[model samples]
Target chain A: MAEIVLNALAHTYSRKPNAPQDYAIRQMNQVWEQGGAYALLGPSGCGKSTLLNIISGLLEPSDGEILFDGVKVNSLPPEERNIAQVFQFPVIYDTMTVFDNLAFPLRNMKTPAHLIQSKVHEIADILELSPLLHKKAKNLTADEKQKVSMGRGLVRDNVSAILFDEPLTVIDPQLKWKLRRKLKQIHDQFNITMIYVTHDQLEAATFADKIAVMYEGQIVQFGSPHELFENPKHTFVGYFIGSPGMNFMNVQLEEQHFVFEDMKLKVPEKILDKIQHLPYESIKLGIRPEFVHVWDKKNDEAYEVDVIDSEDLGTYHIMTFKLRNQLLKARLHEDQRIPKHKAWISFPDQWLKVYVNEYLVEADDE
Target chain B: MNKIENNKAWFLVLPVFVLVAFSAIIPLMTVVNYSVQDVFDTNTRYFVGTEWFKAILNDAALQSALMKQFMFSFTTLSIEIPLGIGIALLMPKRGMAASLCLVLIALPLLIPLNVVGTIWQIFTRSDIGLMGWSLREMGVAYNISRNPVDAWATIILMDVWHWTPLIALLCYSGLRSIPEAYYQAARIDRASRWAIFRYIQLPKLTNVLIIGILLRFMDSFMIYAEPFVLTGGGPGSSTTFLSQALTTMAIGQFDVGPAAAFSIIYFLIILAVSWVFYTTIMNMQKEK
Candidate 1:
């Protein structure tokens, strides 16, 4: 395994690609450590796959230097990079037996016959595909075909890394969990550097050691799942990471107090001072749905809210309300009783975040 | 609501069956009748009991034509299949270039069979055609109208030019049907260009290639119009294929009994060969 470094990486497909806006991927500087399981996670058209392709040597960055183990590899082809990939759909030689499909790369590399059989058997056993060894790949079911595709990547031990691009999208929902867990097991056993690309947050959270959340052709945040969930640096991160994502309500800061509609709430003095000098006309208070506590009546710590609707989701209730005419969601315990017409909630100052123009503003200690 | 049952669907196929019966079944029965009889015109017919079959079985002319047909089919298949695939591989996958390539390839297929023959007839003449004049200027002694070797080369080249694009277009559609993710996976596997073609592209192309081979075989075996027009079975009958021989017996000699017998045998040969090709390809595909 080798540490891969991307230095000032940017790509543009046009002939005259000098302008900053012409680039699909802007200048990105990052290091993917050896033997780490990383994921490039983003919505469609977000350039996550582009970044993965560039790293695999399938695409050359218009301006950048990529180094593998401190050796320049930007000019290398995929064959020279020594990496394996599993696609969203299984790509197997349909005319060959399942065994042949797995053994093809080894055969191309001129591995000895005995070693090829042993390696094929080893991977087949791990993937639980021993029963399909003699069958033609085209005759297999979709999941079986996908297992063959995965085995082709896993059977080789000499590769530097394995890249997966939404490899489970075609899998049945019931089988996705099993395959994902199996992949994690394989990674743990092999300790190979793996980079997976997907738009599914749950898949990225469950699979990768480090998740790089991308948006609009840029890496919005690169951190552990916990870090991304707890302390999102950008507004898009807050809006994207959760199921019922974080809520952002506009507020006005005056001294150590913040005003929302007719209500004034006290904030920490330092946070108030940090925002006082900003030119923005409004500040945003961001909080996750689970962190907001709903109350039955007005209290010193609570803000008045007009309840709109409540949806019971078996394990929890998703309560929707209007604060200063802006929609907000609050997750409450399943058994908790909430009043229909009116409700009050407390935005715990400790969990509350302040933002100015999508960038997080410093919070002051009161 | 209950699902609608359409038992009357058979009515929709009745006309097709009648048309096929009139066009295929009646002629087949007539050929079978002639195969077993001796006829001296519409006035007299006699039961001959497979005498013509025995004669055809031993005839040297029949044997030579059969060998020629086999060579033609095999050569055409070998040249067309790979050339088509190579051209298709080089074609742009999408956009204006794809449409342009498609139109250019399809142009030859849309030309009438007789027109293709007439066009090549003039195109290969030593005095007027660009190809013939260029060959002469390059110091090559070439004349399709007089030389057997030139005749064979010209016919083969014409067939290749007319039909290779069909196979290529079919293979092109097959290649396009593949998801981009597969290519990505191949790249990730660090598969060499040869490995990618052998393992991924070729296997994916099997179904279309089968169609291409069968179609090309059937078309090449029945070839008559172009060679008949260009060579006119000349240079001592070097290019007189099975179809031309059958037509000579039926139309030129008016030997109905022998011609009918030959037609039946010719039809069966094509059917049997096509069956073998289909079965072998399908079986190979199944093994994978």
Candidate 2:
């Protein structure tokens, strides 16, 4: 395990980094601590994989330095980085037997033959791949081939980190869960620094100790899965992390009152004073589907809604409604029923989030 | 699943099958008919039951030509496959450069085969040709038309120049088909460049290499036009490969029956050799 420090690291594919948009990855300042299970999560083409590649030393950054355990490694190649990586698809040597595929890196490093055998057997056992060890790798099932890919990476004990790049995308859903669990177990047992890159929220939430949410080549937020869910730092995060993500309604803020369309809702005295000094004309209110409560019209704080659609998802229902021309989704308990024509919804004060120009506006100090 | 209801799809392939059968089957029937007969003139002919086959088998010249053909094919394949793969590795993976390399490499293949032979014949001449002049200026006695060593060298070099690009192009396509993710996986494994090439790139190229080898072997074994035009199978028959020998027997000596029998033997040898190469590669792939 090693502490990885990215010091103003940036990359540009072009010769001249003349424009801001020309950079594939902007200056990134981060410190991923030793033994931490980190995830770089984002949509496609967001520089997540690029960042992973830079760290792995497959690509050189245009500027700045990367330090692993306080030693500068920006000039090091991948072989010198001492990291293991599992790719999106299995990259096993199809001509080699499963045992040989797993044992290749060890053999390349000139590890003793007996030790290679024992270590391969150990990883095969952990991955439940011992029975198929004698078989050629090409004949294995997709899931089994993926296990061989994983085993190849895992067999090396001296690797400073293990990187997984959407490794489960090709795997069947059933096998993905088992592999995720197995990866988690390996991480726990070995305590190596692991960085997993994926676009899937569930996989990110399940495997990562800290999730670094990336959008448009920048890390928007880096925190635990719960922090991302409860307090998204950017609007992209709010819309990206949850199943039915947080809904945003544009509001006009004046002096001490917030107006949503024609309805002026009194703001909490503290939040009102903080935004008064900012020069933003509009404030957006964000609330998760689980936080929006649908209630009777007689409820004092409830705002009126026109139900758009309702999808029954076995355990719960996702009820989509419109409030002042903005679409909003609400999650209701299995037994809860609401009229399709009109409904009243209310946001709990604690769960209400405010954003100014796509950036999260922190709550005011009391 | 029920049988696919797309009957119209068969129309897309009908023209191809029809063209292939017309070109392939008719010529094959002609060859088969010629193989079993002796033609004395336009009208006089006799059915020779395996007499020509026995004569061809016993012919010392035919046996030597077969040996020379195998050696030429083997040498050409040995030189071209690795050279092609090396050039392919040096090629850029993307952008205009990759396209440029592809176009340049494909130029030779696009040229008519006889034209390639004619061009090389002039290019390797001792007096006026640039290659010959340069070699002479560099203090080497090089005359392809009269010297067996020079003739052999010129032919091998020409074969390499003409066909190495094909292997390289096939290898390039195979290399390009590999996803970037595989390289990422290699990097994470901390694999050396050689290890990655051996384990990942080489195995990935095996299928294409098999095809490349078979095509190159068939072409080189049957090579007649280029060497015939350049050296005229002279320099003392050193470059007289099987196809040249067959041409000499049929056209030069006009022994139609023996030549017909020789061609059948030649075709069978190619078929048997190609089958061996294909089966060996497929079996190796299966074992993996």
B1-288: candidate 1 lDDT, tens digit per residue: 998899898899999999999998987887899888888878798999888887776778877888888888888889999999999999998899899989998899998888888898888877998888889989999988789899888889999999998999999999998888777777666668887888789988988988888889999999989899988976788888999988998899887777777887888899999998899877755553
In model 1, which residue pairs have backbone atoms overlapping below 3 Å? A136-B288, A271-A364
lDDT of 2 by residue, B1-288 (tens): 799799899899999988988999777767778879999997999999899999889888778778878888888889999999999999998899999989998888887777888888888765777888788889998887678888888889888999999999999999999888777777666668898899889989988998899899899989988888778887888888888898888999998888888888899999999999898877766663
Cα lDDT of model 2 by residue, A169-230, tens digit: 99989989998999999889889899999999999999999999998878999999999999
**Residue range A257-307, candidate 1, lDDT tens digits:** 777778787777777667777898558789989889888677877777788
What are the candidates' individual DockQ scores? 0.56, 0.57
Which regions in candidate 1 have their CA more than 4 angstroms from the true location? A17-21, A254-256, A364-366, B1-17, B92-100, B129-146
- lDDT scores in order: 0.85, 0.88
Clashes of each: 2, 0
TM-score of 1: 0.91
